[model samples]
Structures are given as C-alpha cells and as structure tokens.
Target chain A: MNDSKFPPNTNRVAEHIVGLPKSGIRDFFELVNAMDDVISLGIGEPDFMTPWHIREASIYALENGHTSYTSNLGLLSLRKEICRYVKSNYAVEYDPVSECIVTVGVSEGLDLLLRAIINPGDEIIYHEPCYVSYAPGIQMAHGIPVVVPTYEKNDFALDPADLKKAITPKSKAILLNFPCNPTGATMPLDKLKEVAQIAIDNDILVIADEIYSELTYEGEHISIASLPGMRERTIFLHGFSKAYAMTGYRIAYACGPVDIIDAMMNIHQYSMLCAPINGQEAALEALRNGKTEMMRMKYEYRDRRNVITKRLNEMGLKCFKPVGAFYVFPNITSSGLSSNEFATRLLNEQNVAVVPGGAFGKCGEGFVRCAYAASIDNIVEAMDRIALFLKR
Target chain B: MKNNILRLLRKNARLSVENIAEQVSSDVATVQKIISELEDENVIRGYQAVIDESKLSELQVKAIIEVHIQPQRDGGFDNIARRLANFAEVNSLYLVSGGYDLQLEVQGESLQEVAGFVSSKLATIEGVTATATHFILKKYKEAGRLFEDGAEYERLKVSP
Candidate 1:
C-alpha cells in the first residue's frame, strides 16, 4: 500500500515514533540478507554455541514442568547468583533481595533503567563510536542523547575531559560501555577514575553496560561502580549474551541502589514481568559451570583478533589492535571511500560483508567494524578478499 | 606457548607456519624454532587426517580385541605389548585394568581377515591366555567431528 494516497495530515501515528530515524544497520542488513555466499564480519555476537551443559540445564528445566513465570524481580536463586557474580568480578556489593532484578537481556535492562530514571528532556551523555542502541534507546525513553566522540588516536578510549564538557545541568546519567562495541575500546582505569569523579561532583548517576567485560583480553575490565563514591549512584547492567554465547537466551540483570532498582523493577513487572524461567535456569548453569568454555572462546577470539588486525594493517587498512572484544575497527580512508561505500562495494565484489562504522555514529564515518568472531580461515579469506577489493 | 601451538594444530594441522604464528601471537621465527624443537623432542609425533573409512567404497572391518596375558617375571606385560604394537593391523594398543589385561584396536580389509589375525597371530602368542573380539558396526563420530551433523553458522549474515 503506497502511503502517497493518504492526505498529508491524515497520519495518526505517534509523532516521536514517526520522527525517529531508521537504524543504519537495518538498511545495510537488508542488502546483506538478499545476497548469497557472503562471509559476514559484521555481527556483534559470539560465533560459539551455548555450552552443552547450559543448554541441558534449560532442557531439564522445561522437562521438569518449570514453565511458569518467575518472581517479578526474577527467580530468587538466579538473582543471588548474579549478585555473587557481581561481587567477585566487579568487587562491588549488593543485596540480592532489593538491589537486583533480571531482565530479558542487557537491551531490556538498559531500556528499563532509562524509562525508570529519565524525566522528559533529560540528557544522557554517551561516548561514540558506540553501540547503535544508546542514542535511540535514550530517545525512546524521552531523554536526549549527548555524544562525545572518541578517536582512533587514543585507541577509542573515552576522554574524561570531553565527557565532562558534554555534561549539562539537564544531564541525568552517563551511559558507559567499556570494552565498547563498534570500536572495541576499553577505558583506562585512570580515565575511569576521572570520569567517576566528574559524575560524583555533578551528582549524576552512571548506567554502566558491561556486557563485554568477560571478553577483556588485557589485564581486567574495571567497573566504574567499583570506584570510591560511585556504587550508590551507578546502575550495573550485564548478561549471559556475549560472554556466555547465549544471546538467544535473553537473560540479563541490573543491580543498583534499592530505589532505582525498585523503579526499574516496577516497570519490568508491569511489562516483561520476568525473564524466561528456562533462560534463567540456563544462565544459572552458565554462571556456575560455564567458565572453562567461556575462557576457551575468549582465547579463540583473541587469536582471531591478532591475525585479523595484523592482516588488515598489512593490507593497508590501518587497524588499531583492540585490546579486548572480538572486533577490529579498521580505518578504510586509504580506499578513498566512505564507510558505507566501502562496505557496499566490498560486499558486491568480494562477498565479504562488514558493518560500516557510520552505523554506530557520525564519528565512525571512515572505518568499519570487522568482527573476529568468525573462524580463522574465514577471517583470513575475508581479509584476502578485502585486499583484492581494495586493489581493484 | 607449546601447548597453545599444539592446540591450534590439533584442530587444523594444515595451518601454515605464518598462520600459526599469527594465531599464537608470535613471530614466524619463534614459532618455527618452537615447532622444530617440539618435533625433535617427539612431542608432536605426526599429523594425520581424521577419516571415516566407512565412506569409502571398499568395505573395511574394525574390531576391539581384549587380550588377557600372563606377565613375565621381569618384563611384566611390556614384552607382550611391544610385540603386539609392531603389527601393522594394530591401530591402537592399551594396557587396561579389570577383566582384560590389554585392549587392541585392530583393522582389516574384511571381517574374515581380522578374525584370521586374532586366531592365527594373536592367539598363538606366548602368554596370550584369552581373547575376545567385538566388531564395530558403524561410525557416527570421529576425531571430534560428527558424521551426520556438521556445524553450520545459523546466525544472520549481519547484525548490530
């Protein structure tokens, strides 16, 4: 049905929903899905399967007639495990009873937190190139998204100075994703300390999406909440998606001060009610016994990271070696094409698909994110094809 | 580092030295030296493909034979095990505890040939007290690969 038949003012859709821009990634994805024999280096999730034991736990849960809805705050046992995990990994403490609530995934957790906290027109400061969801998520929650550009010169690390400059009196929270997506950048601890101090000084809350923390290849991923004077003001979001290779399970959790967590849970109970019980059971198994497989996959990603980064640089893509995450954000400026142009031509000519960095934000205009989650052979072949594409 | 190299090779032995070096995060020279050292020390005995002989047109037979042997005064079962290991038909040999003294995986062109080996050669050996052979009927999985289900990447071609 062509919409041109309708009068100009006859539309009945919500103004905000209609005004929202379509996702750039979605447009590129349609083109990719229509093609055949494309080697994708664009997906953000893990290539590994969910470990058998975790899958078996969910199977067991289903077989034992555990199909009912869990508590509004999620299963008590799963929440307790999540708390313990947070305590050990982030060196922060929280009461499992009041301060934790399981959501569908980090995606839902972020949405819940934003809707719970954001007053209309409140500003959320985030760094870019970033995950594509942050700006739109904030906008959907009726908050304004303020972006600070992180450059390749600094290895895409968020500069606290710029972050400080972006904050305003209307700023409600700072959304931080260390070991970030689209850039594969992690904030330095000292910089994190500075950012935490700035937030404390301004009395702003922090919404930390640390979904990729476990895949850190460097020393360790430092949670901003762990810093002094930050725990009471930070919302920590993590999930079984990236680290556990359980993206399809849709199990993640949020932990914060009782008041904020209660607010998020209020929204959660009204809408999602609770995360799926089977996914929670699977996540419980993952938290308990999934370390070995998790580490194996992490090591594999690290290996692929090394090979791909080296190959990209050798082929004149000028990639920065990301210290964590399974992606290499290679600068494609040498090819004299915009990120989208390069991605389109490479896909059409060589059947190697990569996400244009511009999909993340404007700061990502000249580069493309090449996920190293693929097999080494595929990554090597993709690099070769990309090289050939550049040559031609 | 050695273990890491071996792990990559275990998955795919055909990787070039440069590929191995990149995967292991080492230079080619260092990887080359380490691989040569491993070869010299016999840590890497050989590289062979994992094959399912059942796929071939020619019919093949395989059997796991349990051998109960009497131990010599000084040599124990080592003398008999060494003698059995030299046979070309013996694919694998292990000295297992329990009812059986030694277990052997023997392969042949046919069931008759394998049965003949057990009767004429294995049973005739000194201190070979008893033998029981179990024939393998089919191959489902070999060397960490499934014959029926190959892993296909079912995820979307591109995502954010």
Candidate 2:
C-alpha cells in the first residue's frame, strides 16, 4: 500500500488545492534574492523598525512571562483599546466582550471571517487587482469569488453600478481592502457612501479590511461601518502591521455584529486559538502611543512617493499618484512589454526589484506596483537604474 | 510659515524649497519667499556639512578647558570668551554659568599642540586664575550626529 498507488488520479490532492495558483509575488522576488547589490521596492511594509516604545512594551510583557495564548477573544484590555481606537477615529463601536476577536493578523482575520460566513457555492463579490489573499481566502472557504474590475481612470475605486450588477440572491458578502494594498486606492466619502448603500440594499454582509487605515495620507480614514446604517452589517478588520510597523508581531482584530463575531470566535477557538499575547500588548501600546511615529513615517512615504512619481514620469512610466498607501501603480505600457516581462527584465538588468501588477490580478497586467516604503536614497538609486533600463 | 520653514531647514538643510513646501503643505513660491526672508533676517544661518574627522584618516585630539577668570572692570567673561572664540584651534566657547566660568572646546593635530596652546597662550591671559583641562578620549555623538560606525544592515528580502 505504501509503495504502489492504484493510479495517479487516486493519489491526487483535492481539486481546489490543485486548481489554485500560488500566492503573490514569490517567483519574481526569488529572482531578486539571488542577486548582488539589488534594490527592492517589493515589500508592502514600513521600512522603519517597529517603534521603540511598542517593542519595549512587548519586551516588558514577555519578561513578565506573558508568552501564553490569550483568550480566544483576546485580552480584554486589548479589545477595549481596539474599541476606543475605532470609536475615536472612525466612530464605529464594538463591545469589547461580545463583538471583537483578535486574530493572527488581518491575514488570519480574513480567513476566519470567510470560513465563518461562507457556505458552499455562496458568492463573494470583491474587487480585482486586490491584495493577493482576497480571492484565495474566499475560494478556500468554498465561496465563489466574483470579480469587480476597478480601473485606473476611476482611481481604482469600485463602481457601485458594477457592484449592483454583481450582486444576486446567492451573494453572501462583499470583501473590501481600502487604502488598499497593491493599488493604494482609497475611497472618498461620497464614493464610500455609495458602496455602503449598495451593501445595505442587498442585505449583504461587508468585510471591510482596513489594516492600512492609519496610514491614510490626505485625510482621516472614513470607515463604511461608520456611515449611516452600516455598523450592524459590517465586519471591520484591522491589524497592527502597516500602521505600527508591527508586521512581525502578527496580531489583528475583527469587530462586528455579535452574531458574526461569535461565529468567527467559534472558528478562532478551535483553529487559531488566540493571537499571541505579547503581540497584543505591543499592538495595545501602538494604539495608545504610536501616533507621532506614524505621522513621521507618513511624511517620509509621501515624500518618497513624490520623488518616485516625478522620477517615473520623467522616465515615461505613467504613475497614478496614490494618496493612501505607500505603493504607486505605474503604467509600464510605455516599455512595450507586459508588466511581468518588465519586472523580470528590470531585475535582471538593473538589479531593482518591483512587483508586476499581474501578480495582483489579470486586470493589473499593464502596470507595475512599486512600493516607495524603501529609503529615499535607495528609491533615488532605483529610479536611476530604472531610468537607465528604460533608455536601453 | 517662517517658523515652520526654519524647522524643516533645521532638520534637513539640503531639502529643496519644493520638498519643504510639500512637507509643510505650502507652495514653492511661498516657501522660497519665506526662506529668502529668513536668510535676510539671519534666522536661517549658515549651513555646514557634518563630518566625522576620525573617518577622514586624520589623527586629531580634542580638549575641553574650564577657565576661571576675574571679571574685568567693565566686561565679565565676555571679553575673554570672545578672545577664545577667535582662536583657530577653538571649536566652541561658551560663557558658562555653573562652576566653570568659561568652557572651551579646542581641537588639535596632537596632544602636544593642545598642551602648548593651553600652557603658552591660555595661561598668560590677564586675570586668568584656575584652569582645568579635560582631554576627550573618544567621540560618541557630535552635533546631533552619531560617530560609531558599523556594517550596513540589509532587510530580509521577502514580505507581503
């Protein structure tokens, strides 16, 4: 029995696992890694280390032996802080005891939310060219992903008309990532209001992944859950990764109607158990004291964005100036090559690493996403090399 | 506007007016005009590159001298402080208010030169009384810049 399979078909893994493509940006980055003097604008994280005070808090917690898994709903103090944070900033309220569960990251929160709500063949309508995990999470939960394509001309904002068209009686939820990764598109109040209205009309549950909420540049982040009639129907997800430079800590939370959160906590209790208590302590410190550092990093990113925008446009790359996250989606159609070919060639020739837009989704083909979260000097140098590549 | 511009220039003097304007959310012409006004008013003083002399292959020694002097009939330590400030060897001089009447930071090519300056020039000044010279052993931080050098850190290559 161990030596011989009945046939290859008998030994095959599940069809869904076989069908799903590998998750994001791995191959191109592998080519980047085995190189000398490479400059990567590839990562979607803050270049700065986690702020000192937050790290210090985690260290203090660990020194006091707080290494155990927290309660499935997380430490009450952390949940309380999450409530105060969302209330003060977005005016969205969730009871610490009933309506919030701290998970591994926004990554894990996505998984828990999808698993909690989706039934077999339930449709999840989400925008294309989103963070790499959006579609995969829905698909893994046995939910069919319905793509709504957002264009650069629309500043990557989802059209409500398209949303209405995508919704059906089978549509179970709408997944959104704003100040979104890869695209860096933020929904303004007017546009966000329309999206919220569409969700209400369909009675669709909304999974708002707002991890990058604090990094918003131009204005305060406006949460759809904070909009009229949206609170009860939304599962608000956020994490300490982007804003607090705590990606390594891997703790985030999902807050919503108690029923949905209860379902999520059910899964959380079995599988993930709880987010790390040390990370929760660090995230709590960030919520309490990391504001000034966030502002400083925001200014750095904005400046780097300006430098990249100017330099890329100078080299004939059409960059959509993004006002939210640290990424810039530059149309590399001028290079007369697909974004994949462009990224491969640039990495090979100039030793500069950037993610091809196609890695995000098919709609992202002609563009390349450059994360300006790198140092200004490296950005300048990468631009110089890219300019040289463009010329050649 | 003026104070904001000064604050920015203080942090990074090499920043262009356009960069400062964007940071402060003002326009280029306004930032340029404000900077020009600051220059005229001497609020924006000179700019100098911070250099680590030890890294330049030059052997240098520094000494901080605390000199007590009886006040002149008219001028306090200001006269001697100004005199000490003019010396080419002096890096900085302050009319300090604590136990030390005056503080002088002096740099030289060797300890002998620094010792000679103190014994020959500083000791002969009229009304000069007690003197305590503290030789600096190492430079850790100077002018808000760190001097300790190490390997350039490379971040881990993979992240989402």
Candidate 3:
C-alpha cells in the first residue's frame, strides 16, 4: 500500500492532455446551437450527402454480412484501389501490400503517422491557419510543433524562405496541407517545388495531407510527394471525406515508403485494428464510381464560391477569390471588430453564423471563414443578411 | 456563359440578375444582356414555378394521352401537333417516337372532363387514328423535387 505510484489526491490526467487547449470555436458554436433560425456557414464539412451508389455499396456489404474487421493494413481490394488512385492522380506509385494502411479518416492517418515517426522533443513544422487537428496531433505524439506563419499577401501559400527558416536539426517532419482549410489557399507549382527542394535539403521527412486535392479549382493539384527524391521522404495522406462527401464514413488511407508505412500500420494494428469494413466497401465503390458525383459537387462549390466571394467583397469585406476548397476567407477588419467579435455580433444581430478566423490560428485573426457549402438560396440569403448587418 | 446562365435560371427562375452574374462569374450588365437576348431568341421560352398540384384542395386530373396520327402530306405531324397544342386542356404536347406520333399531357378539373376531352376532342381530330390515355394517380416527385414528406432538411448549426 505504501508503494503506490502517486499520492491519492494527485491529478490523474497525463501532462500533455492537461496542456492541450480547448478547441477555439467550441464556446462560440455552443452559443450557435442554442439560437433559433441561425443560418450557419461555420461548418467545415461538405453539405452534400454521400452519393447514393456509394452508400448503396456499403448497405449491400452490411446486408451480406461483411461486417467483420478487415486486415490491419485494410482489405486487399481496397488497398489496391488506393494504390491505383494515388498513382493515377498524383503520379506517385505505392505497393498495396506494404505501403498502404487505411485509417479511420485523414484525421486518424495524421495521428498515426505522427505517432510512428515522432520522437520526444522532435519538431514538427507546419503552417498556421491549417486544419485544427495538425498541431494538436503533433503535440499529442510528444512532438514540438513549430509554426510557420503564412500571410494573406502571398494568398497564404507557404513561402519556401519561411520553411527554410523553420527547419532545424530536430525538425523531423514538415506537415503540408495545400489547398488548405480556413484560407482555401493552394500552392502554385513553382512555390511547391521550392518547398520540396527545401525539404530535400533539410533532410526532413514530409507529411502531405491531400484530403482536399480533388476539390482544387484553378489548376491541377501538385503533390510534393511526386517531386524528385520525395517519394522516399513523404507520407501521403488522402481520404474520402471531402472528395466523396463521405465524412461520416471515416475512411482514409496513407501511402509512403515501405518501412514508414509499416511503422504506422504497426501502431494502427494495436490501436485501431483496422478501418471499419463498411467504410472500406463504400470507399471501394467511391473510387470505382464516385467521380461523377464528386466532380459535380466540386463544380457546385466553385459556383457557390464565386457568388459568396463577390457578395462578401461587395459588402466591404476584402475577400480573396480562393481557387480551392469551399470557403471564402474575407478580411473583416473594415468592420472594426476582431474575428470573434464580428462572428458573435453577426450571429446575435443577423441570425447568420460564420466561423471566426482566429479559430484556425492567431495568423487567421481579422478574417472570417465563410463556407459556401450551403445551398445557393441560403448563401444568397445569408449574404443579404450579412450586408444588412454590415450596413448597421 | 449563355448555357450556364440558363441552367441556373432553369433551376431557380427567381434568381436576380446580380445573383446570376455572381454565380456564372459574369457581371450584371452582361448577365442582363444575355438573358434579354435569350428571351428575344426564345432560347428561354418562359419562367414558371414547379408546383406540386396534388397539394391543392380542388380536383386536378392529369392524363398522358398517346396519339397516333396520319402525317399530312405537306405539314407532316406539325399541323395536327399545332392544333393539339392550342387546346387549354393540353399542358404539354410533344411529337414522340415509336408507337405514338404524339404525346399529350392534359390536365382537367375531373376524370370525366379529361376523359371527355380525350374521347370527343383528341380522338376526333381528322388525322388522329388511335389514342391511349393514362391518368396520373399520385406524384412522389416532380421537376427533380421530392413532394410531401421530408422535402426540407436542416443541417447542423456548426461543425469542424
């Protein structure tokens, strides 16, 4: 009894868990949930339901009793499809047997990759105004997250100079999510190449989160993993959530060199065991037949983006015409309000909801992320309401 | 640009010139001009609501009438088709392929009136050789929109 590891009244949670800050948008959205008739543009996921055929495939699978766990690496058929998809789209090849592991989502894939490669105190350099989970994921894995601040002046693309400045001997990996969340910024080819070169020179591993690659609008999405000498140094993460509107299915995959993928899968096998079989079945159907619906949704988002961006700019919010993702990050400083103040007052006054840009990162302050993933009618109505609020 | 504007209008005819311009990535003046030109050219024939007539309290009988017509020597089926198109009961009329030369969607106040129109008016047309009429029972969907149950849904107020 006297050999107990800790005092009776000590805090039970791990130090890292205690250190993590709560989601920046949580309290603001909780207010949103209690409001009536709120037209929300705060959502990060697509408005489209998963297409019928893909859902039908999953139903077909479950009806036929295909509910058991898959191989830790995932069903062979699905892995083969993943390899094929990666090769055809990104111009990078991976062996299905040893170089791929299907995880719960790109979220899980990121977590697994971080856990597999990060040593205690190893630095993970990622850009700010990124997906909410990236920094926290690194920190959870006991890695120090080093932030590289990208600016609106460059359309939020990562400056290679910034990358070079952020790298250190302890910087184990650089996490890149182009056509990024929040800002909807994409890297031009030359800039992407420059960043790739910096990674190669620094001898840093790269984690490319490309879940939104299929949503790219202006031009082709270039994967850093496809660059010379990058195939061995990059872990490529892709998923069905954004592209297929299958966020609820929680299915994604990781592809990289054999040894690293094996390491991630080793952690995955003991923890997650495998991605749900029904999700794999749905993803299989998606890769086979989901292209038409996916493209249709992408074009819809593009149209919505055009209308929302124009409307926001018209109302005196300086909004960038983002060429990727379904968001328009409009600079709201003209309203003389901080991001949270603007979002809160807009919600309270107009019954229209948008995310405060500070929720993404400190660099995201003075802006607000308006998702164009709602119906054109709703978007138009929201824009009118926002205009009224701005006028007031 | 013309097709994109028309597609948006087709889905939602009430969209303002400003809204349409933004959606199609054009300007208001250009969108207004294109729409005016379209209307002048009859590329956009008319704008109307897609009503779910079944919701009305009054009786609304609709029939799909397939007509076999003897094509006129000079006018082909155009003469009879034009005549059929003029009838108030005919909601839509088209020159169809295969077993029928004409397809007519006719609406009337009652089944008797629809039957009377088909039998007395449609079948007695000089070139009409045969007619088959089928009455619509219930509509689960119309104009790409589901009717009745769950026609509208609201998504989560906020999400990550």
TM-score of each: 0.96, 0.86, 0.93
Q: Report iRMS (Å) of candidate 3.
A: 1.0
Residue runs of model 1 more than 4 Å from their true location after superposition = A1-11, B97-99, B150-154
Q: Native contacts retained per candidate?
A: 0.89, 0.30, 0.77
Error of 3 at B160 (Å): 2.4
Interface alpha-carbon RMSD, every candidate:
0.7, 3.0, 1.0
lDDT of 2 by residue, B57-106 (tens): 88899999999988887777778777778989998888878896889999
Candidate achieving the largest TM-score: 1
- Residues A1-392, candidate 2, lDDT per residue (tens digit)? 35564555663777776567786577677777767777889888888889889999999998999888778899999999999998898898889999999999988989999999999999999997888888888888888999998888888888888888999999999998898788889887888899999988889999999988887777788998999999999999998888888888998999999999999999989998888889999999998899998877777777677778877887899876787888888899999999989999998899898889988889999998899889877888899999999988
Model 1's CAPRI class is high
lDDT of 3 by residue, A31-87 (tens): 998888888898889988899999999999999999999999999999999899999
Question: Lowest-lDDT window of 10 residues in candidate 1 chain A?
Answer: A1-10
Kindly provide the TM-score of model 2 when superposed on the true structure, using C-alpha atoms. Answer: 0.86
Please provide, for model 1 over B1-160, each residue's C-alpha lDDT reduced to its tens digit, 9 standing for 90 to 100: 8988998988898999999999888999999999999999999999899887876899889999999999999899999999999999999999998999999999999999999999999999999999999999987887777778666765688888
Model 2 backbone overlap count: 0
lDDT of 3 at A363: 97
lDDT of each: 0.92, 0.86, 0.91
Off by over 4 Å in 3: A1-9, B68-83, B95-101, B126-129, B151-154
- Best of the two (2, 3) by TM-score: 3
